[model samples]
Target: MRMFLKLNSLRKPSVHVKAPGVLALRWRLQRCCFCSSPQNESSNISVLRHLTSKIKATGPISVAEYMKEVLANPVSGYYVRNDMLGADGDFITSPEISQIFGELLGIWCVSEWMAAGKPKHFQLVEFGPGRGSLVTDILRVFSQLGALLQSTNLSVHLVEVSPRLSQVQAQNLTGEDSQSARDENEPAYRRGTTATGLPVSWYRRIEDVPVGFSLYLAHEFFDALPIHKFQRTERGWREVMVDIDPDMADRLRFVLIPAPTLASSTLIQADEQRTHVEVCPEGGVIIQKLTNRIAEYGGAALIADYGHDGTKTDTFRGFRGHKLHDPLEAPGTADLTADVDFSYLRRMAGTGVACLGPITQRHFLHNMGISIRLQDSPLCISPGSAAELPQRLYSAAPAPGLRYAHQPEEDGRALQIPRPAEPPAPLLSSGRHKVGEEAPSTTSGGWIQRTGTLAGEELRSTLREGVIGQA
Candidate 1:
């Protein structure tokens, strides 16, 4: 979804999902290790029933609560118990497509680590590392650059709540080298070492990760965080809540409360412009944590998710079997997500960190010399698949599997995909720049962030070409 360029080849004719919130559908590459809802419709009942019990006791629940209980209830929650990734699951991530995404990221990590003066201790902390593909790719990069990391003590810390997916990450990354903690109550529930002797640890939350000059990565992670949906009313803003539909015992519906709830009153900005907004306090809290660490101890965080910069409203959506579905229907049977508001994340960061919101995979990769990388690699798409998509969806000069569904136009400008009947979404254009020229920056938005004072002059100059600026 983070990639604004690549819209999935829709299965249902004329049903194109809007972007920068993309869910790519393809013939398949890797089977996602995450558990998914069984074909049996009865399997979703437990989550639905539990929600009804909570609602009956507490009245209508906020959208945030609905998401939390439905996706992470610890008992019948979707993510807590499902394998919902890839072609067979509810979604597929950029990492699953090709090594370029992760490899470029790995290179960025090394570059940033160097910028941080090459700390003796390096921690690669990733949130929601599905099947461990991204981190595995990064680790390989680290090993490949033996001398660059030779003197640094490196570790992998993952903040993941899913026990089943944790097992998958362990099997893929550490194989026989990892083990569950003897005590279930430990802050780190699982611990392991890779074949190359790098230690890895897993935690249910980010608060437990040790503070250090670390590199933080969250790919397709923030959008899944529960968001409080609000609608601007004639008098004021009202929080959208979910309640049992009076006419149907088995269904849920959205209701606008007459008065603002604690969330609507506190989270909504008085200067708000959007008629609707989705705010994720959890995402804010996580950013605050990362920024504080960046400010205090010196680290960086690169968050990749589909989001708009203070521009979009009403992007909460659901996906089941790779197509749009009613978020309120069937409860835990689908994957519920909202577009990340990068502007809000900047507000939480509080100017302490140099935050960059969105650098399209196109810009970021091109800036990272992906053209050279692809030329040296063997990965390729079949002519059959290539012939199916519009030429603009792909540039004449190809980067293997880089279709990430978006292609730069002939004029070298990024193309914005609009939803049917909706205006063309505002282009997620990073402000302009070149070497020694001041770059335009809005403190309220952007994605890739490098913290600390040592962002490096050369790094800044090179990155400025792609709009990766120094604050």
Candidate 2:
């Protein structure tokens, strides 16, 4: 008999029910509120059984393989489910937090495009664009560039795997039927035009994007890719695997392969100390592809995610209902993710590709003149609320890194802003600097593109005291 051990002490039991029939009724009623639905749970059980059978037949699977199955398996994958993002979902992204994030990014894109002498035709691509909020905000900002918009033939390409998220992204992008709607038999690449007349397309892989001057944005993307975990043992490092828990037939647990193979040995080099490390070869592979695209074609790519510069520690975690959960507890129920090793990314970028700062997000935004934009805006909020903006923008993990790479011909200037010892104090300290005070001038030209008319000035002045940046 399999002895089931409850690993999650934090998980609370359902409310008490006296009668057996009433208990069954209560369970049916309460199932909707839980992380996994009864149907989903049943599906998970089936998947679990399938995995167990596979393991018994073929031996244990790598952590990456397990993650690939649980989070991206076509039929029963966690991302395949509709409810997987936002406040009600597993976790919220930075763009979902504030429009300011995407707006600044749009300004950066415009500046870079101008720096590149304004390419007549280029591809604007986003990888794993969750719900399309960031792209929508970016396009809105792009719309401010009137004549520039007309001159540039911008084609939007979203690289995504989840059909459900693609639908949401389509709705956000076009406000109607998506150009590249879900068709299992659909070719690797599909194209369409948005309601705004901008050419849009969907690609399952980055390689499918037509070669051209391409600007790619990947925010909180690389972390979700499956990773291989290795622990330094007395002899050497061993690869982590997922197998059926001997004590609990229905549960899964991590198990290390007994012998260290050449592949595992070549992949990771660890000291004698018992240290844990994670490597996302999938992420590394994607970086290689991206860097190749930028190097061969003329353009830039910006990757923003919470991670360290090659930290040798295990950062694998799961999130559900805005709270931490055991990653091994319930497969296909929570968001599984691991910290990115930015050093790995830099190394994979290759010889000619120039890499920029893996600087803190606070430093990046501040240097991008987030404060200046906030001061000139027409949003309203309390001083206390405004103070929390920096903290909120501070990622779940510290020091969100930003990497910028471009072709040698297209101005290889790095977007690295000097990091401060600490994040600057809030601009609106103690209610000082009343409305209509002269805002400080910036060296970087304004990308907001305000109309130079008396009525427009009046509107700007009115919005000067608003608190859109408080987020």
Candidate 3:
């Protein structure tokens, strides 16, 4: 009887598991009461029968092997030891909701490093730099100007691949000096007590830093990489993998297969139904290698995230301390994100890089001024939070049902939505022009799109040839 149906499918499954310090011995198994299987397909067929019985007694193993002793074998892997974010870990980032979102991204990184022309040795990167409070409130607003923070040449990189949030952003960028410590040699700046000595550098790849002309800051970093989910079906899109269970003990599974590529499946079969696509191929190859290194050494990248700018079907989910959970129910112990079509990251950052404003993290921090850094900070000379700081920089309290989902263009009919308006300023200005002469046309009638440059175009071809419009 095929060895009693392969020893009753490798026995073991009377339930009552709970490792760590042991307490799991209850099997008198019988199953087959009209066997229905499920329980995530009997925990992926007992983890593919204990990896083909350990590759037939240890031998042929490559199915791109990585069951890590069958699902994070132990000591977690979802980021092996989490602390994802706030309000109790996972989901809270907008520079963890305050310090006016890292002091208006430190005045939009000093107006994109004075529009890159003032680059002395610019490289103030920060991808996944949580807990470093938006790079210490963008280096305390680049130490309040002070001649553009002492004529640039600043180096404050911090890529971070979580060694537990890079030791909580090197202990919150050497604690204390919460804005207004203008380094007049204010020594002893905490963190493993290195004394005010700020000169940190940490990386986990972006080709191991080193490259130049950098000024990127990712915030919510492309909704936490690792996505690739799918589900269109009816013979078009499928993929969605993850399976575990060594004779059942904390199961864990999700299997689908078949989706090789319906144009890089982000799952969308439509009239054929089944729609759950969610790709992120390493956040579109590290956002086309950080916009081809800022279009070959120039600079400027912000990329805030929430997602939705077209091409539908998005699958990105997770959450911890705040609850929602189940990104494969704890593979590395929770914290996965998604939603960033950013118009396919602005058609893969082309036109030699210059795609500002996918705007709306409340209109790019209220047009990168954060209502004049909250009416010139000191939270406006406090006194019961000054009229709610201009109603928390222009009101936001009416999201009860808020269901939106429409935008999905590229000939799938209308769907480029997201234009509630107000993210035009940031073509970078602080003196002399010419970077493709500050584009900004909107001949006016509404929806006048021009983005980077076209505001004049030979002064509108000299008023359409009637030279200066009949003077």
Candidate 4:
């Protein structure tokens, strides 16, 4: 992670292609998190100044601290004030890339909801919902569920720190029918209602969201949490620190602490083999909370991000505009993130809950029946890197309920929630799926129309297979 301490040129958005009924975005989904917005460059100078002052007053700060201040510090954080998630912004998300992405994940949610025996109350909790496109696509599927959900009470809860992004999400998800909380003391900082009349509430932290039969989604969210870097040394692992470059007063650089710090001593395992490691304590804490909630209240969590199962070492980097940038140079001007260590997250989940495969994004989507949509679609991969991306980014989650074995496809692992022993098909799949023919149910037709998918029947069988799996 020894990146040059100079800012790179502003980056560009994803390479977009236009074909009938298709938009193929060529970019790595992991690189998509918290890119940058050119509009915020001049205003981002405040964070560098703020970090300089803090480092001078104290000492070299941990990498985690620097990331926290750069990305989510209350005032001048990058995410706090920028619309950084589209063609004009730093990068684009899967949701922004294709409506199909959200629609499939939405189907997964409904599959889990049905597996949960149709709980009277359902909460759709999303963390770091950029532009709200993902959840919007999801709610549309919920709307298509119709009669199945008429008896169920549904609500949306978002955990977001950026007021600027929150407003963008409110506009997209709620049609401007939203308002800020009356006071700072309230747990929900903002609240709104969707066009469909579902309540959407905003919170700054995960624990504040209400507990019940909840479906938790974290798309590229954990990768944004601050991580501490450690380099294996002859004596022991040394924690990486960020400090003002002694040679250049205006610059910042990485430093290695000579002695053992609490993080270096506690976070690493005894049998660790990697020469370099990055640990995200904040991500661990959030996982513990999510799993605890799932174990107690009976729900599921789906986490998708650019990550590894503890294989790679040096992954912490920055993205400005759309290209790799020096993480320390401009501070809040670039997105500072590290690849999420799903292995670390699995360990944090502990034996209290079952941990599933960190499956390939391609496999998960294929299981979700994305191939059914790509049939006639032509893809022009961009930057030559997009072709290399599918195997790199992965997803991990427990099934929405306990009973369904929910075995994963191929190498992907899926966590399953325990409930009464029976996994029913997704509500949309209520009618038998006959390949090459539309589902007999009219709701199925409405679902396909609502999602704007061209293939009406091809997805039914595969999507059902993606749902409850063999025990």
Judging by TM-score against the true structure, name the best candidate. Answer: 1
* Order of quality (lDDT): 4, 1, 2, 3
Estimate TM-scores for all models. Answer: 0.76, 0.74, 0.28, 0.75
Query: lDDT of all predictions, in order shown?
Result: 0.61, 0.56, 0.42, 0.61
Query: Which stretches of candidate 4 lie above 4 Å from their native place?
Result: 1-36, 39-42, 373-471
lDDT (C-alpha) at residue 218 in model 1: 76
How far residue 377's Cα lies from its native spot in candidate 4, in Å, is: 11
Stretches of model 3 off by over 4 angstroms after superposition? 1-115, 119-125, 130-149, 152-167, 170-172, 175-214, 217-224, 230-234, 241-249, 257-278, 281-298, 301-330, 333-471
Quote the positional error of residue 141 for candidate 1 in Å.
Answer: 0.8
| Comparing 2 and 4 on lDDT, the stronger one | 4
Better of 1 and 3 by TM-score: 1
Comparing 1 and 3 by lDDT, which wins? Answer: 1
> Could you give the C-alpha RMSD of every candidate to the true structure, in order shown?
13.8, 18.3, 25.4, 16.6
Instruction: State the lDDT of candidate 1 residue by residue for 122-241, as single tens digits.
Output: 789998897898898788777776766899889999999899899999999889888888998888999999999999999999889998767787766777899997777676787778
- Show pairs that collide, candidate 2: 377-463, 378-463, 379-466, 379-467
Write the candidate numbers in order of decreasing TM-score.
1, 4, 2, 3
lDDT of 4 at 258: 75
Q: Residues 1-471, candidate 4, lDDT per residue (tens digit)? A: 000000001221121211111111001123232233575556666788889999999988998999989888878888887777764566555564445566667776665555445567888999999789889878876776565578878999999999998998999988779999889989999999998899999999987899876778777677788999887777778887888887777778777777789999999989899878889998889877876676656566777666566777766766555455657767887776677776787777766655444434554565555654334221422222333323212221111211213422222122122222221221111111100111110012222232333333333644444321111
Error of 3 at 122 (Å): 7.9
Clash number by candidate, in order:
14, 4, 8, 11
* Alpha carbon lDDT at 437, candidate 4: 13
